[model samples]
Target: MSDQRESIRSNAKYLRNVRPIDPEEICEYVAGNPHPAVVRQQLREEAADLRLIEQDDGTFVPADDEPVSPRRGPVERFPAEYERRLEDLLVERYGPNWEDGASGDLLRSTVRRFKADYLDGRPVEYNDDVAAGYAIYHLPGYYAAIQYALDDLADRGLLDRTLRVLDLGAGVGGPALGLCDYLPDDALLEYHAVEPSAAADVLKDLLAETGRNTHPTIHRTTAEAFDPSEAVSGDGSSDGFDPTAPDDGFDLVLACNVLSELDDPVDVMQSYLETLAPKGTFLAMAPADKNTSVQLREVERELEEERLWDRDAVDFETSAAGDAERYRRGEVTVYGPTVRLWPGETPSDRGWSFDVRPDLDVPAVQRRLDENAPDDGEHAPGEFVNVDVQFSYSQLRLDGRRRIDMALETNEWAKMAEMERHVTERIDLVAAKLSRSLSGGDGNGGRGSGRSNPLFKISDGSEDTDHYAVVTTETALNRPLLEAGYGDVCSFEGILALWNDDEEAYNLVVDEETIVDRIT
Candidate 1:
């Protein structure tokens, strides 16, 4: 068996660049003439190691080396293939009419219970039923949100063609599937997911439907217990493993919607950041709710600018002899959505920032569940439809690459930190539009009315307190504040800065006198 495997690998290495390496042909070349099915299984297992992309016709070819082009527009809908796949899983668990029977009631209650637990800041365990319910309730929105967050990296050409990604606490594979579709077909991906729950079973089933170039492995262990060295080395032993070495660490580490669930999120995040490749990105995402969004920023702030050292490279006993400095790994820096536009400034406010994109077209399963829901007091019309894409994400990179890498010149615009002195006075300011119009949005937690002035959260990355831009009287010139997309930087001319005593936030009033222009 060992000789057959080695002979197959040898033939593949020689034939990969020359032509399509067929498993049938390789089987004939093996010492004992192993079955073609066995050869195919072996090829699938070794695809990532060999950098081979399995073709639709069961042949293998070399992966393209070009970086994936960034997607230009919004994700309109979840793919029908994934929707069907999730439905299939639901059917396998609970018969074909899953949305109408007792199974439907079970799933509906499971979703409501978990949602309530999340809102109340309680730990909800992921059992089989809970995992299925989570897929039905949260999958579509999470799928759309991740793609939007990933745009912040892809727009800057930071995403690579050949990628090694580590997804921590990857539940039911929403972000995983989104990422798979986000990359171009020619790009190769080696994905490792750490999920220690029944969700791993669901994740494995969904990942099987991904593109041929995507090779995934699910480590059935907790994030804290899963050692990245095992994935990097392909073995449990980490002898002489250097995480900082090129081609050894993950290119992207994702902790989406999982940090707020951890006991010590900051420490765990710091440990994961150490496993990032020199030019890697660590993206953390959370729900748009105030508590979770603020907690995400708090984690980002705690790890920002802190230099991490490669523990394996540093000799702790010889640390007194300058060993630590010699083994310095990388410094963490915020890479996007949020900004640190000023050179020496960082925002110290309660950073409750999030981006809201167009809601996705509801998936079939969600629609089915919602349409057939019981006519009970608890069921609302749109209760099961999870298509709103509102999320807070922080991209931390070791390479010091920012999505918006402009240093604001104080001579041209007023700093948000100094807004106190300019209160009630018209001033020129440059800031990123962090949120959509809060005028009639649900972002105000039912406090805002539809007829109120157009309000948005804006940040220049130097404010010590929350700063908002309120469009009091929208004219042709000041309409850009309302027109700009989330995270877009805009320059405001002659905007009045006022302290809103009721909201306890600084409101830069944009009126007829204010001229707003989106700075690309």
Candidate 2:
């Protein structure tokens, strides 16, 4: 190992140009079964701070994009202190009338009502006093969701410029606050916020918390009612309705957590997309509920047909499958014209549950709980309810759209899948049943007759990867094929319908019956 290290010490110059070093592929230069120590030694010799980052899949990859220093963990921290101050102000606002001690139960109930109103897409007529309290309760979770969304945007090269942001229905400016935290110290940002709620009253105060880092302008109007032509374009000056005018549109448009509440959300989204400056992004996010997520998907679908934007979902899905399924790859600007849940975020049986910390301090609630104290003295008041949040988000843009006259060539799999889904045309792809080992079912291509839904993996003719899909068929549909088919499993080679899946693999349905010639 030492000899190899000495031999490759000259190679350190080449390694310096490679920022992120994949730990897996680091051994090509060394001779005959080089021990892992030699690789480590070479990496250290090249760059001392280079570290192996464990990905979500538990594999180590070089942290090339922006490597963290040493073992200090993620550079981003939740803005807990900034948020805590706002909660303190909420309690202070009600302190004057609390001499007799507040009702912890009432405040808790009010907070719960605030949350329910948000998810149910209903008006929050809970009064100004409770509105402030609700912000105190929900801001952390809102910040978390917006932070994750903005983090994703930042990673996609969308935030590379000095950001000019327009946040619609900006709830107390949470997305603006999250954006402020995401940018660099010297990175200038101009933020414009549109919100008609009483929550808008405090958005300036919250933006001020960023302390000299951001410039915020609050537009006090409902999104649908807000007119972009009349909007001040953040340059401290007014401009007429010229699209080519300076300071015309936003680089980042945020319709965060408020899409479902708008009167005409699709129309509002169309308006928002128009206000996007060239090379701009529009993001729409909602609570991680089934309805809101589904609505966002519908919005994504509608946007594809709109003339303003070229869709990115197809390229997004194709790249995810990488080059092996490059045949399935679509143009970077084209999409399925359909919006599905982002991968791994499919609503589970328990529904859209996101992580939250009920552990944050709630002094007023605590006082009320303390006053109403039981003799047993266990459990925090807010802990018994849902306080944390998860959400679904859709990020789209207008920069990549193919012009109206241009033709869109569909990929083979997408075409075949579409044929199966719509035309009811049968197509052939090599498919294997999803082994029942994961779901505790017998892998006999089981459906009904005391079996789980039939799931399968279709090969893409790629050795290292396979596409997993599921098809819904009754025992009757697959039974005939099986009689001609299996020694142990039902393997089919032709005429299957494309069903839903994680995009890497899918669920495909077989025809009612087939002659068994393609079985393996």
Candidate whose TM-score is highest: 1
- The lDDT leader among the candidates is 1
Residues 22-126 of candidate 1: C-alpha lDDT, one tens digit per residue = 988988888888899888888876777777777779898887776667788889998888888999999999999999879999888898999999999999899
| Model 1 score (lDDT) | 0.85
The alpha-carbon deviation from the true structure for residue 481 of candidate 2, after best TM-score superposition, in angstroms, is: 30
Off by over 4 Å in 1: 24-29, 33-37, 232-244, 310-325, 445-447
TM-score of each: 0.92, 0.55
All models: lDDT? 0.85, 0.49
Please count the clashing residue pairs in each candidate, in the order shown.
0, 9
Candidate 2, residue 298: how far the Cα is off, in Å: 1.3
lDDT of 2 by residue, 56-95 (tens): 3322333344311111122233466565556555556666
**Candidate 2, position 31, lDDT:** 59
lDDT of 2 at 464: 25
